[model samples]
Target: MENSTQITIENIQYSLSDIEKDCWSRLVNGAVKSRSPFHTPAVATFGQKEISLRTVVLRKTIPETREIRFHTDVRSRKWAELLSNPAISALFYDASTRIQLRLNGLASLHQHNDITNDAWQKTTLSSRRCYLTLHSPSSFSDIPTSGLTEDIEQENLSFEESEIGLKNFGIVSIHVQSIDWLWLHHAGHRRAFFDYTDGKYQWMIP
Candidate 1:
């Protein structure tokens, strides 16, 4: 028979297991490093020369190295800010789960090389199709009445073959210093902050 018992602590219902908490942390980290488009976060930044904010996918995460990766176009406005100041912040919110993660870190741009080549090699043809568009990302122009679309399937292009796009493709990495996680529960609220700078982590006042 399955165990059927109602238990609550401080009016909050949860399984009494530290493993779950540990697993959740690992899962969150995995999401931060996921390659899939669905796993990325919508990035935001303070305006300097201009407002620099856009959706960015999580390309890679190296725990040992303490780094996070994202891809963008070199011609984009965000790319300019990244060059001027590597400090950047990211915000993530999950409506279904009612959870939010705010992170601040230093950013770095990766140039085309063996490491970049490896990362580019994993992109799918459909994903690469996004790079085949016109180079100007946020340019202003008038479009003619006629429009055209290319048959991406017939391209038979490898990930590396998008040399032109790859040339413009910029990899932005963030070395996380701190991350604030907030969860809104029906019974109450939970908030925590993880600081990677020091060897230990302490709960922050929420």
Candidate 2:
């Protein structure tokens, strides 16, 4: 029943480094595996007006730099909020693994640049549809809407046609400053806090 790290009186099986590796492993999998629980995380932002939270798909993760990336429409509210306030936090949880990760970081926006260009090149025509909206996200409409024109909504765009969406597509990168990891188990629970700024971590009572 036990693997690399097991529930113990002291719960010292996983070292700080091991925990960090596991954290990134899950994140990487989340980015590539659509079924993974971590594939979509709650991204939160604190702006001048209010605290905004939204669930976004995990597009990429770079462990070396502790950076995470997600795609967003340049006109989305979250994109505007991040531009105004770089502070951000992403929360992830895997029920099957009984693990939770909370990441605090600063966000940077990329548009019409190599970063966004690469991302756009990898996006499918269907996935690029959101960026072709007639109105910016959150814009009040006469009726509830997805923001796309009726014809565009009913058909898929060609690769050439999808090019127009690139103007509205952008990449949101989060430079992780710290990570709070938690493992839940019936026998006991384990918690750890990692401070990337100082490269230090410590176990916490769970």
Candidates in order have lDDT scores of 0.62, 0.88
What does the lDDT come to for candidate 2? 0.88
Q: Candidate 1 residues 73-190, lDDT tens each?
A: 6777787777887778877666666667777788878868776777667766666666565645666658741111344446766545665566666678888887676667686665
Q: Which residue runs of candidate 1 sit more than 4 Å off their true CA positions? A: 1-38, 47-51, 144-161, 198-200
Against the correct fold, how does model 2 do in TM-score?
0.92
What lDDT score is found at residue 146 in candidate 2?
Answer: 82
Query: Which candidate leads in lDDT?
Result: 2
**What does each candidate score in C-alpha RMSD?**
6.0, 3.0
lDDT (C-alpha) at residue 64 in model 2: 88
lDDT of 1 at 107: 84
Each candidate structure's count of clashing pairs: 0, 0
